[model samples]
Target chain A: MEGLSIKQRFQETLKSVYFPFVAIVVSLLFGSVVILATSSTSPLTAYGHMLKGAFGSIAAFDSTLIKAIPLIFTALSFSLARRSGIINLGAEGQFMMGALAATAVGVATPNLPAIIHLPATLLAGFLGGALFGLITGVLKVKFGASELIITIMLNYIAKELISYFVNGPLMDSASSSYPQSAPMEPSARLYKFIPGLNVHTGLLIALAFIFLYYFFLWKTTAGFDMRVVGFNPSAGAYAGMSIGRSTILALFLAGGLAGLGGCIEIIAVQGRLMMTSFAVPYGFTGIAVALLGNLNPLGVLFSGILFGGLSAGALRMEVMTRDVSSSVAVVIQALIILFIAGRQMFAFKRRYRYRPSSEKRKGKTVVDDATEDESPTVQATAGEGE
Target chain B: MNEVVSFFSTTIRLAAPTLLAALGIVFSERAGIVNIGTEGMMLVGALAGVIGSYVTGSAWLGMLIAVFVTVLFSAIFAYFTVVVKADQTVIGTGMNLLASGLTITVNRALFGASTSPPEIDSFGIVAIPGLSSIPIIGPIFFNHHIIVYLTFILVPIAQFVMFRTNIGLKVRSVGENPKACDTVGIRVGLTRFLSILYSGVLAGMAGSFISMGMVSFFTEGMIAGGGFIALAAVVFGNYTPRGVMLSSLVFGASNSLMYRLQALATNIPSQFLLMIPYVITIISLCIVSRKSNKPLGSGKPYIKE
Candidate 1:
């Protein structure tokens, strides 16, 4: 690795993460232009606020890290599934279900040791998400159904199901009126690594999984099978790999990761489940994180942190300068994604524009473009990218 | 029975949006490009329609503007996906978020509130002279608004388009196999772009119906996940115009039924009723997905060398 030239290393990084890197830069530039046109707040000040809010003080850093913890878990889950060719957009719903499952255990279970209680709660979360993911995965393999439709339908179903649970089965009788569950036992809470920071041991747990995922992908036979299946299932089948099993496992693992994120949120971040809240957005954002990270386990950490910073800063932006809507962050993120999608379009146009007419003599194959044929304004009807 | 008829009548009115949106998805998807961003497209169109109507005080002018603006936006999508060849899933998802955020941001900036759009006069109901006197179908079918009639008119037009013309054949050929179509001189990208633009126009109409017809208002997230449901209807309809209309009607009536059921007290939780459409979507998809039936090379990028 050390013998490799700098240019080679740079090229490799570009090959792996170039799409997201370009997307981020393009989005930022677009964001700066928008800010310039509208708000009195300069890009530098907005960025400064973001940096300060994310890492200015120990408390801020802790808060940022804590927020990123669940994202890390879910993003990693998405990466795992992506590697196996399953687009699991249901992580948000899975995350919520996981939280609901974990909370139920914590609230219902009797006395137990802190160690056992914490792990059990987390296990419940993982199992719930894994089960949810596997149901879709299994149905896909067994029934040849498009996972896309199933996952989307399941997402809504799960959302409503959980709403019902919280509203009826899980509602806290003692609390006033709103639909929400009781806080878990103190024993169920994750232990803190950083004293007084409220930074739970979940960070280390997330990091640990990252390392495990890295090793699993690069060093294990099962990982190879999953990757192979992802690249070409027919080839994997011809090579004696069980494509069905790999798909199921990949999705299950992804769901487990997302489930763990939900568990972390309950035990380490938010204490209990709340009905009609924002949980799925993070799941959707995890796709961005995975893209930003180029699907590398280690890269996800940085990307998650970056997105976490944006979220943290958005809150600050909202509080300090109510004049500038915090939704600017979403716009920025959307721009990054837009640019990435449009990157090849621009490149193709450049080629057509710059290349001499005589140079286009060969019968070159055109890449078939597939994208949503709607404007961003029409996007509200679609919701979170079904 | 009167209550059912009244509800059914109201439902056809409500279903106007879904039917239009489903038709839009059909055009885009039948051209072999999967359009998952119909939700975003509708929102943009709705906002465009509202803003246009508000500024000009003309519903006709508003519809025209909606089609034009939404088509332009769809053209951007077409430019990126058709010409540039980006990952459709990622691009489509990003487009959805971008559109949603941008519109809401613009709305808040313009309106000073993140609530409903300013109201406008709805399209007046049209009574088909003697048909209004028919027994069971009378009030539900004959006595309806222009938009409702328009939806019905589009179905046969859509069917004719999908099955009759050279363009439709080209579209079908491209969707099934771009390579095969390209070999025979069909320009897949251009067809897809046109189809998508067509989708944009109808989707705008669907959005406008919500703002200008159903409620005469726009709220944040007003498309309300109908875009995806429409996409689901595409597969359920098996890419045929007639099949799609039937699927749309089922979904529309289901949505209407849920609202009606909501009016009456039932033992089951209201959340369960809300979940019915989504649950049915999953069940139906599971069934559809069961046969491994889909357009060949569906949603896959077509690259020519």
Candidate 2:
């Protein structure tokens, strides 16, 4: 709760940036070494294709952003729940439910204009996902069931339910075909921002949600309650916060974001619910996005893009390289999660910053600075500190 | 009547792998560390055992190798979760993902991309000579593969070890109150590490049973969600070997019922019939939550003061 001046705040931010930044570089370095050992080809050439697939061409970059859009929402959903100290592993299920709901809405409302139809579909998706997550949250709070297991089990249940619906009630009657819903009306889809590009305004909406997430988490009373409950429910209760309410709210809010992701995925990219195969597993990948982004909304925005880039590139690499499949990116993602989970990055920071020589001096400086606040003293090197 | 008996007997055989895996999970989780990676561990073991048996042309050797390699990785897994203080949940999830990726990658490289490996008609039935006269009881229970028989024997042995042995008491105590046990001179972390290693052996055995005993070969994600089902059984059994065995039997029965119901196809679609197992699981889980008997500090690892 201690508020610092602009310069000191900048210094604190700089201190915190090292862990995530270094983690990325180190993980990529390891990926490079792995590439060299396995491929027996220059790792650079393969990485060049990775770069080309993500950013070398306008088409590639746009597709990357398109893939990134839903992830930003799911990651933001994860971050919101995480800040309050609950795990929302159900986001993938929620996201899928959202897609199912939106597809139903999109197909059912073909006569409506784009403006009316699009938002309605999204709202349905959001509500579906949010409600799905809320069921687990409510169960955990009311009945002491574990949300982690419930969500995992619910994922299979949800998938089967959707398959049943699509193959039966919602099956497109035009053709005897796969278990996929009818395509959305062109009017129901997101309008592409650039003339011929696949990238649409969904990215803009996702970014907007990211900003809202940041504001809600960092600058609101309810956000404070969520964070307090996250820190410790007993303490939060002592502080007059309802832990149950916060947990429920956090899950639904997170689920709402994921629902939006699902809506965007269907309406913008696939224009239909893409049948899940082992080939592309984007749902689980959101956890990596949330971790790589360090569970920050804006950070998730970029990390989502990074993963999307990997997703874009790795698919190509599978064909272009032949020996290695796109699933190799999975190893990299796992390594990132593995390294980050050890708390080693944070502990390493504590070790360096609390070095014996630095600690005594820094401790003295902290006391001195606290006392100096009484005098309103001005100091030089503020720019360097910032 | 014969159809019903055969159906149930087949269910027992089908559930043998899961029953064994659930028992494995019971050992590990009772020691207080969650082993959600049981699925991945099973996959790796299944692959390694199949490959080993294929190359060596001896199913027993392959099964042994699977157990060793899986136990080795479990040690690595133990080191990270136990020694490094890595979060078990994340590590477990990573294990599943890693097994899936590596299995396919290695399978392709070795066999040039065949999904099914060569069948080893290696594992044989353990037909007890005197027990055969017992009719349905003997056929349903005693007459089975060597591993299945071993599994049946081991469940009782596991129950005895967990309830009767001093080491078992210490393991359970470490899970419940590691601090108190540590104060009294028990090595909490080491106990957990050993328990996890024990789990690895049983889980490996289960996987090898599938590859060499259940099916003739291995396929990607063949373990599929069975490992997770074992996980549910562990929790549902309240961490007792007997309880775990019973739950695994129930799961096995439900799965068998689904297949039978699918075959009947009187009115319901096969898809709907296919959904029966998961639907039953969800309903059972909901009921279980309303009345869970989870041990205190079930997921918390002991941190010695």
Candidate 3:
């Protein structure tokens, strides 16, 4: 490890940053083509409006930040589970459960001070999402049910649960026409920092979590064990790490983080829960967010903000240009995921000038490992390389 | 007796899309790609079918266009998973999002917001001359859209092709062990690409049936979760065409039952009625998890050195 120089370390980090940047640019370029084909307005004009809409003014920046808060938490949820080698697709459901639990607690508590009530609601949100995640984790461990299918089923169930509550039992009596909950009392609501700006203290919580994510995952022993299990369960087992326990724990944390995101969206932003909520695919978007961030804590922060900016800008572009649908943001996001996932296709050449031949040899071995399963060819290749 | 006939007819009608999509998935899974993007591919097909029909004033043209466009989309999936060695599940999810976004964006652009697009001519029930007179089976199966008949016929065809052909052997071999297939001189990438394209074509046809055969107009997200249910059918069917067809019938029957229950106007909440199919899928999946046998390399991407 000590044999690496400063230049090599810089190149490695730059390589990590390069693909995501290229992916974003390529996606946006492809997006321009879509806009050109569909709408009368030029892609440049629409994109110009999007940029202006996202960050041209203080209010725009504020909206972008506000929109990014839930994404950050959801991305954190996804990245945490990915680190443990579990693809937690239930973030959408867990986030909804968190919002539901927070709304329930917030509506019930009318006398507590801000400090007490806020923490209680947050805890409720975490527990709700955690329990939801635990169901999938436990199912996978005990019954071997694929989390992918289970989580998708759970998301549908969660959506139905929310719809049932808002329409039947938890409906606001004062607003009979609308299927939504009663607004939270002032004591429970998150305070806005700037006057007249929609930005709230939830940003602070998200930032704190970003740091905690870095510290907990990189600095803690448990986090290391989870990552090891994720990388290779058999190897982790050989190293005395419990794969099942790590799986469950990582998912729990993931769900709790996403739930906290849901809680914040309700308490700090929306104030009440609607039956038809999450007009956007925030949970799915978070997958892209985690991947674009390369599953790094700080990287998630930037990618979350970038996506939030896109979301905010796309809405404005739609409003300003009547023909442009905000759903184009979805296309751009999908394109980003495609490009990032297939970054190997865009690799021009290896940058390790000092070790290009050896690196190419290593790359060949990796490809062999990927396409083959215990074949003699793999062994033959490995022997020749050695 | 009339209600039973109506129920069976509706069940077959509803099951057609899932059956078609699952049939396509069987090919891809057998060749080593899971192709979860069927939902997205179906969505694109549905919308494209409507657009094609509206433009050409021919529903058949719409179905053709749906297949063509969806094949293009599947090619993208093929490029990413088969050639680029990306994760299949993630790419599938991305495809879904892309389809959802692109369809809405294009729909809004083509036909402005809020106003309903003009309805185009679509496939209707086609009764067979002699078969329509069969006592029990006539109305239930003999009298339906041409797509429905095509779907049923495709099942047996799929079974035959998958079980008794050289290509099928190559595809299954690639999935079971790509390394061995490669050693034996099979073009693994090309086989996977063709298999994925089969899924793409069928999913598009499934989408076209929804927009043109079942409903006359395309709405945003008209495909809904039909693709996902098809995916479940693929799983429940144990990766066999006939098995997938049977599982699709079960889901189709549940859908038909839901419509019937709604017509009865019972006091029960609609949400619970909607929940029925999903609940059944979850339960079935849990039970099947104990004895499941997915393709060995179903979700893995192949990367040759």
Candidate 4:
């Protein structure tokens, strides 16, 4: 790969894209079967409704972007942590903590100027999520706790914390028994940037972060060190890189990104943090998005929008097709992840047929070419070769 | 004395589902597969149990159906992780999402988004005739749901089977070193696959215990981190059957105490009370992680070269 021409590298990347494309198509096909079995409406009709709902109008596109903004943020969070070799399953908790902190800051000081109030609220949200994510990193490094289990535990704990706050200390008194916080001050709100569209400045923020994600990972020395550690922890340690620092810093940034998403979601879209705000599962959906995008920043942007379309469209599909539940979106999302992760299921028999002949050649250049031809399959099988 | 007796009785009852699932975890983890999908499998089992009883009107048949469905569900997980050599944790997360979505979709499709949960035949308490008469021991140990007794009885059997049986040795060997097992003609993939399916069966039974044995109906997200708690118990128990039982009992005790505090109308918020088990799991994991005896091949895809 290092010796490959620029065009060859670009072609290789493009070839990898087809795997995710195939996964999406396969998942949607499975989803159609579910729709056919569960509802009276034909799968075609249901899908038609979904398409119309997602892209038939200016309003629908706006809804798609609005739904996608948070997903992109969370996808970035997952992608960053993953690139650094840590599976941060606590994005859900981090997102929640972010929203919680944003709410606290957004509502507490109502009279401040927008510049200070809004940034402070956003910063608070980021800090909240970062701190939450740091717990997993700290526990893993210090106590040898499995981040997989600990992150899951933190998710439950965070949910309870939200329930406790919304039901008691932070409950909006003027709302008369509702378990939700008061609306953010006008200064703290994120106003719409696009003319006549419901989408907020969050879209701009998402785009900026996407670029930053690309730049930081590809161009920065710190990001390179983190990636090296993620690729081979022992080797990185031998090379004098601090695995702990990379892990801790990666999680902190990852949490902060997701937290920023939560903050933006509250200020731009929901207006107030409610118990029901998390019902959509932005964090988990972001995982699907991240995987679909192959963990590329540009790929994340597109997949995020694609998932957002699914969500926005499913609501309309449910309304039009009374028997089809909107949860089909979730099924499709999960299926995509399954298909992407187990992509070997889709690998062609050509690989098997080609391998023996390649081995017969046994020339250095020929073997390298053979490996290059089967690079995707080899990478898929050996990506986690630790 | 009555409070103490009832408390002990309640602890066993509360511990039954998690205990059942943890026993299953012991088997799967011993064979080198981390059954993170246990939570998802349990959720699917709970729904299947209700559906089965709703259709058949027999609680026993419902339990059987639950196990059958979960075995099939876990088979998909096994195929992906074991056969395709995908990352076990990634596939597990997918299974969880799939289960959650599938359950809700199927439930609403069948029940029409109804507010009232569907009613079905639930397991009944069975007391041994003479054993019921004993003052403290009978009620606490003998008189309760049949699942409770079966769960407690399985602990010793699991301990014996795991430690003494040849099959158990093969499973432990596969988990610790799959490559060596493969060289010795042990069929590592098949052992891990079967171990996961066995875990699925117990997880399904545990799910049935929650929806049918403990209550008469299934609710969305009813497993409510019970699977995770069971996983925590597996770690806290040091990967041994007896240890898992003790860890599950401790969790159950904390859960029972939370309920009691809620019943007594303590100043502590009910939400915080509900958080006790999860909090305890985290704290316990921290303490137990230092001396971890986790399977060497756990969470790794065993690719045959």
lDDT of 2 by residue, A3-83 (tens): 899898786566446546666666667666656655544667777777888888999898889878877888887778777
TM-score of each: 0.90, 0.88, 0.93, 0.94
Instruction: Give the TM-score of chain A, superposed on the true chain A, for all candidates in the order listed.
Output: 0.84, 0.85, 0.90, 0.90
- lDDT (10s digit) by residue, model 2, range B168-228: 8887887766667778888878888898888888889888888788776888778867777
Question: Residue A150 in candidate 2 has what lDDT?
Answer: 69
lDDT of 4 by residue, B155-255 (tens): 99999999999999999998988878888899888888899999999999999889998899988889988998999999999999999999999999999
- Candidate ordering by lDDT (highest first): 4, 3, 1, 2
Off by over 4 Å in 1: A1-7, A14-18, A33-44, A55-57, A341-386, B113-117, B124-129, B290-293
Superposed model 3: Cα runs more than 4 Å off: A1-4, A350-386
TM-score of chain B of each: 0.94, 0.94, 0.98, 0.98
DockQ of 4: 0.47
| Cα lDDT of model 3 by residue, B1-305, tens digit | 98899999999999999999999998898897877788899999999999999999999999999999999998999888887767777788889889998999888888876897777979988999999889879999899999999999999889989889998899888887886888889988889999999899999999999999998988987876788888888878888899999999998999899899988999988888887777777666666766665766667655454
Q: Looking at model 2, give its docking quality level.
A: acceptable
Candidate scoring better on lDDT of 1 and 2: 1
Q: Which prediction has the highest lDDT against the true structure?
A: 4
* Candidate 4 lDDT, A159-278, residue by residue in tens: 998899888888888997999999889999999977899999989989999999989887998888887676656667889999889888888889889899999999888999899999
| Candidate 2 global lDDT | 0.73
Worst 10 residues of 2 chain B by lDDT: B296-305
Question: Clashing residue pairs in candidate 3, if any?
Answer: none
Model 2, C-alpha of B66: deviation from truth (Å): 2.2
